[model samples]
Target: MSNRGGVVKTLFKRDFVYTFYSWGFYVVLFAAFMISSFILKNFLDGIREEDILVSAYPLNYPLFISVIVISIYLVMLSGVSISREREHGTLEVLFYGPVTAGNFLISKYFKDLCLGIIALAFCAVYFYLVSLTTNLGFTAGLVRALVMGVFMISCVVCFGLFISSLTGRTRSSVLVLLAILGGFLALQFVHAALIGMEREALSTPMLYLRETVSHLFRGINWVSPFAFLNRGLDAVVLDSPLLFGLNIFYAVVYSVIFLILSIISMSLKGVKA
Candidate 1:
């Protein structure tokens, strides 16, 4: 038991160091903060000179944006970690040591989750500074959203690892991950559009197609990590503790299912350079 813990810790430390020492993670954080600042400035400017902007949690939107940015970076980092190790023969070499598929993938998942937590900390500090400058209230809702982000990031990391385990090359893994995520986003947009359209304006065939897409979109909500984040964020905005707890449960289930699939894939595929 101690030996297994040591192995996971060692791998986790190595990946964590590599992630922070590289420029990619910092670049992503910088971009997120800049975008948040830009949006906040414009939002503050839009208020009428005579009118006051009363917001319960103005920072929640920026926090969500930051989470999205960090999630993308960490997901890509998780995918690239496994694929790059395989491409460079590191994984195969490690397999000759005490490493197993379970520990290896868990370490990667933990490393990315840790990175996400660090990013969340940075976001907290960033938003605090923004609030100091802009008077945008940092309420309890922002804290809830940040807490929810941890679960959302677990889902993202597990999903990325699953994709990485399936592909031999780093490029293929990233491409496949992007393609699937893009498809999910496109499906969601189409479903929203269909829902917003006047039912009477649509022909019978169009209505049938819309119904099919709506069902597909509903299914995707269970599979997509972003959907979990969205649901959690909505729950926070709505102040619904029941919905928030349910979303957290769903996120945990999603993470566990994907993590198991990732481990199984790695075991079946073996380590190849």
Candidate 2:
């Protein structure tokens, strides 16, 4: 038991150090903050033009934008981690030690989660400074959103890890990951377009298609990590403690299930491409 614990610790420390120190992580973080700064600049400009600002959660949108940016980079990184290691033969070499698929993947999972937390910390600092300089006031809602972001990033990490375990090559992992995410995005766009139009104005075929896409979109609420993000953010906006807590619980379940699935996949697939 102690040996397994030590193995997890060693692997996690190595991965955490390598990734946390890498320029890629900070580069992605800088891009996220830059986009948030742009959005906030526009927001401030609008407020100045109007001479007044009235909103309960002014910083929430910028926070969400930043979170999305971080999630995208983290997702791609997680997606390629397992496959890249396998393709390069590092995974097999590591497994010759005390490492099993379980410890290896768990280390990778926790490493990404820690990275997300660090990214979120940067976001908190950025938003707080923005509030201080602009007098926009960093509301509690922003803090709440940041908290929810932890769970959101967890789901995203697990989702990407699951994809990583399924494919054996970096190219395949990336292609598959993008295709699945793109399909989710397309479904969302179609559902929104349909819902926005008057039902009575739609033709019969269009109505049927809308029904199909709506079902798919609703099903994606369980599978798509971004769906969890949207739902979690909504819980924060609604200020319903019960709903907020429930969604967090759901996110935990989602992560656990995906984590188990990824482990099983790695075990079955082995550490070779």
Candidate 3:
């Protein structure tokens, strides 16, 4: 096989062995699936209520679950990946390889991202199953979600690798990662507050300010991975599709930029083991 092909097999084999055979992996997979299924079932049943039916909308279900599953997968898998290597003392051992720093980093990033992508695929499956309950259908939404999710996963993996690279031990890295992740999540609530405040301030003659604020929110949405995923789907999945080609172009462009930064960051940081 060619060198690139060999690299592909080596990475794929390593990840499959590590993730599929590990008991911890199975536990996480089972729990996520079971909880997701239960929640979706409850949501479907709840839609029968008059008030709930009025609020029920397409992609609403997907958005709710995506945030939970994606966040957990990113933080937990990253922590677990690095912590396991540190526990086994394998990270230091791998530093002696013929692999360049870039190659090693790419391998780790790819492995983690693949695990996340696979999990997200299962998330998509759960989404499809739930959609069967109503007249709702999914196709374009799925494509955009998958594309955006992968891009986001790539970015998150880079963030995780940077955390892992900070020290020889994984515990410290995991703690720092959780701290950062929590802070980012809290920012979303802050955004909500800011938007509400702006609405009140612009309640008078500055009617155009409302539109300007809304447009600003849409533009700023590109920065957050979760925001982009939610916005892209929300814009396309609902009966009232808000974003068109221009908005999608913006999202795709941003994803590419984030992914490039991720690659560069990972390349610069060598894998110790």
Predicted structure with the largest TM-score when compared to the true one: 2
Clashes of each: 0, 0, 1
lDDT of 1 by residue, 1-273 (tens): 699999999999998898888898899999999988887877787665536775677788878888998999888888777888999999999999999999999999999999999999999888878878777767788889999999999999998999999888999989998999999999988998999999999999999999999999989999988888889999999999999899899999999999999999999988994
Residue runs of model 3 more than 4 Å from their true location after superposition: 1-5, 51-60, 63-67, 79-88, 132-147, 198-224, 238-273
Per-model TM-score on C-alpha atoms: 0.96, 0.97, 0.68
Query: Candidate 3, residue 222: CA error in Å?
Result: 5.8
RMSD of 1: 1.4
- Give the alpha carbon lDDT tens digit for every residue of 1-273 in model 2: 598888988999999999998899999988999999999889889899998885678899889999999999888989999999999999999988879989898899999999999999999999999999988888888899999999999999999999999999999999999999999998999899999989999999999999998899999989999999999999999999998999999999999999999999999999999
Q: For candidate 2, what is the TM-score?
A: 0.97
Of candidates 3 and 1, the better by TM-score:
1
Candidate 3 lDDT over residue span 78-144, tens digit each: 5455445656766546556554444555666677777777767776776677667554565565556
State residue 13's C-alpha deviation in candidate 2, in Å: 0.9
Candidate 2 residues lying further than 4 Å off, grouped into runs, are none
The candidate with the higher TM-score, 2 or 3, is: 2
